[model samples]
Target: MTGWCRRVRRFVSGRHPPVPSLLFAAAWAYGVTGLFAALDPLAARWRPGGGTAVAAVTVFLDLLLMRALDDVRDLEHDRRFHPERPLPAGAVRVRDLVVLYAAGSSAVIALNAAWSWRAAVLAAQLAYGAAVLAAHRRWRWPPGDRLLVNLLVSLPAPVLLHAYLYAGYLDASGHGAGWSGAVAVVVAVLAAGYTELAKKITRAPRPGEPAATGPLGLNGSVAVALAAPALSAGLLAARSQAPSAWTPAALLAMVIPAVAGCRFLLGRARRPCAAPALHLLLTFAGYAALGLAR
Candidate 1:
């Protein structure tokens, strides 16, 4: 709003009144995911935590470059509500973004070659990125297919989480990471389903035609609830089997925010209001907790 602040925003965004779009991407995807990366090191059995380090590095690259480009595509409509964003306000450095995206892709590919399992992870991420670009091109297509694409595209976080859990568990000489990985898989699917259902409810048909199911209605809510206990169970079992300074505290702490957030989202779905970026707060807190837990 002030002259000095405006100049700073413009300098970073490449135009007047920076859109805060990049900031959003950084906080929501990178910052929080960084936490997952940090915590992931703890979950793994590898010396010095190679998998966790690799995963964190690669994911950050995926988000900044691939996701930010997608954000650019939304400039036309986003301007209405987000006028200060880079694309809408014309402050984002298009050339810089172009370079950053290319660099990120190249870096991930190189890193993928460094690890066996990681190559698969990188592939999945690329697949998701391509899917998003395709979906954006066909945004006006049938809502159901669009929803599916969105769900599939948003799955990298949980997938990465699973990779850590799987490798970590197996490394510890415990049962196959497959057991924990299965839980992660189920959670990923359920989370996507709930979100898709919630979004559907948010953008339902005409007012006259009633929505038989509310946001996160039966299928979605139940699915999320199921993931909660599975994760909590893992945490609790970890604590019970080997009580430690970090295990119990981390296990229990996440429950509060996770439950509260789920409840808050469900309520907000019924009637929405601006809350000064509750998403940023949620993501930061969640990711930080996850990382510190490790």
Candidate 2:
């Protein structure tokens, strides 16, 4: 048991890094939910409470669960390319991740079940995640070798998660999503997909590593990366009740991705990968602040 615990710890440290992962989860949960509550005319006065806390915990666990499942699903691929990763290095075993997924998913389901109608959304997310795993294991149809197709297939997971968060906010506030909710979900999804693409737009990827540069080329990849956040921000501004207040922040946030793209073009590869992450974090944080200020 001690050895198993240690292995899990190794995996967490090497792959997930608890501190940043928790921060990302909390930011996503609170930031997205807060934005929905603040932006939705019907839920403008909604504030975080017990349901908010529950949602944060659920997001954190769901992230860990997804990480575990992905690591397991890609174990063979990692052995070929990322041999030093925890699972490939023998620091963690498949069964260890399986246990983690089982426990974490059970907690997620139970938490959402007790909280609100968010359970139905959570169920759909879980079903989609399971189907992805099963499909990957059975036939590998999406083909990890094709970065674009694999990313497209993977996009729904985050999209469903955003929907789940929106649903939780609605349930807690006793409101309907309306068109505002739909717009917020689209914005959040675009932000997420943009971040995913941005991180993969490296000029010099390690051999066999999946990168958008390979499929879209650096210029094309960077262009698409820049486009997503811009589109997302435009939608938010159009939908926002007080666009003047948030528009500046949105514009400033846009500079991060642009700078990151320029850095990639200039061959400064080391730090550019982190740009989208910071951009997304700031965008979400800005949204939460906007909601609270209003």
Candidate 3:
């Protein structure tokens, strides 16, 4: 029992540092959910409810599972390059992480099943995640191509999140976003990809690290980041039923991050990673708040 407890501690502390993880998870939850709220006709106000809270929890768990799996799959690389990380530092073992991943996956399944038929959406998420991990392990995508790699890894997150929310909303409201909803989904997915790219490119790479931004040069990456919100705003404006209160605020929220991204690219900022992460969070939260706000 003691041994198992110790392993759990190491695994949780190493793989899931609470402060940062929870913060990111919170931001991500709100951000993607914002998209759902914006499109939901029944959401007369921008106030999150039981469904939103449930979705947030599920999204957080899914992200946590994916993070653990990535560490497990990239154990060798981490050992070589990121030896201080929990897995590489021997603070946690692969077997322990596997168990953790399995448990987390089970929780996600249970949560989604209880929420509604959203279980299928969660299953699809798991499948995509598995495929991505498999590719990373087998194909060895170019490390220098961090933008594409990050996009491939992170895109499914927003998609699955959207699916989960949509599944519940449709089940409850018996409606869909139709063509406008589809556009919003595409916008959200692209924002997610750009956000992932920004997270990578903003950080000044260590000397021996792979190219930080891949084919997305500093300028290009920042541009994409800035554009994500702009495109979202355009789409929202086109929607007849888009939440009026959230629309402008969300656009402003996106602008804040975009400007910060610009600063990082210009070397005015010392580092790139933190700001972009915050930016992504705000964008999601903006949409979520708008969607739920009465």
Candidate number of the best lDDT: 2
Predict model 1's lDDT versus the native: 0.45
- Tens-place lDDT digits, model 2, residues 1-294: 898899999999998887898888888888898778556766656567887788888888888878887887888888988899999999999889877776777778888787556787777787788788889889977776666787888888888888888878777777566888888888888877678787656666677676645557777777887889889888777666544666565455677877877776778763465787899899878777767755
Across 9-106, the per-residue lDDT of candidate 3 in tens digits comes to 87667767777777777666666555665665555544545766677777778877888877877777677678998778877777777777767777
Q: All candidates' lDDT scores?
A: 0.45, 0.78, 0.66
Kindly indicate the candidate among 1 and 3 with the higher TM-score. 3
- CA RMSD of each candidate after superposition: 8.0, 2.1, 3.1
In model 1, what lDDT does residue 39 have? Answer: 36
Better of 2 and 3 by TM-score: 2
Where does model 1 exceed 4 Å of error? Answer: 1-51, 93-99, 139-149, 156-177, 185-251, 258-294
Q: What would the TM-score be for candidate 1 when compared with the true structure? A: 0.52
